[model samples]
Target: MQTEKYRGYTLWGHAILQQEGIPQPAKFAGSGTVTRDTKVVEVSGVLDAFDSDEEAELVGLSWCRAWVDSHG
Candidate 1:
C-alpha cells in the first residue's frame, strides 16, 4: 500500500494482481470540500488497471469506500 496526500486527503495506491501479465496500479485521489466547517470528501479518480471503463468505475467505487474509511 502506498499513500499520496492530496488536498488534505490521502490518495492510496493498490496493485491489482494479474494472472498472465503485468498488473497496473489503482490510484485513489480524493479532496475535502468544506461547508460550514464540515469536511465533505469527494473521491474521484481512474483505475488504470482495469481493461474497460466499466471496470474502472467498479474499481473507483472500491477506492471510494477505502478513501472514505481513511479520510472520514
Candidate 2:
C-alpha cells in the first residue's frame, strides 16, 4: 500500500492486482505540491497474475474513485 498526504487529506493506495514486485507506470493527477502532506507512492507492480480477471490500473483508480466518492 501507498499513502500520499496532501494538506490535511491523506491518500492511501493499495495494489489489489499486483502480480510482480515492480509497479507499472501509472499517471496520477493530484492537486497541491509534494510536501510532508502531499506525495505519490507506487505500491506494487503489474504482472501476468492479473491477466486472469483483474485490471492493472483499476486498483489505483478504485482508490481514487473511493476518495472522490467519500469527499464528494
Candidate with top lDDT is 1
Q: How many backbone clashes does candidate 2 have?
A: 6
Structural similarity to truth (TM-score) of each candidate: 0.36, 0.27
**Per-residue lDDT of model 2, residues 7-59, tens digit only:** 35554443443334457643332221112234543322332233422243345
Per-residue lDDT of model 1, residues 12-68, tens digit only: 444443345336444333222211124445535334554443454455545655655
Model 1 ranges off by over 4 Å: 1-40
Evaluate model 1: give its lDDT: 0.44
Model 1 root-mean-square deviation: 10.0
lDDT of 2 at 9: 52
Off by over 4 Å in 2: 18-72
* lDDT of each candidate versus the true structure: 0.44, 0.39
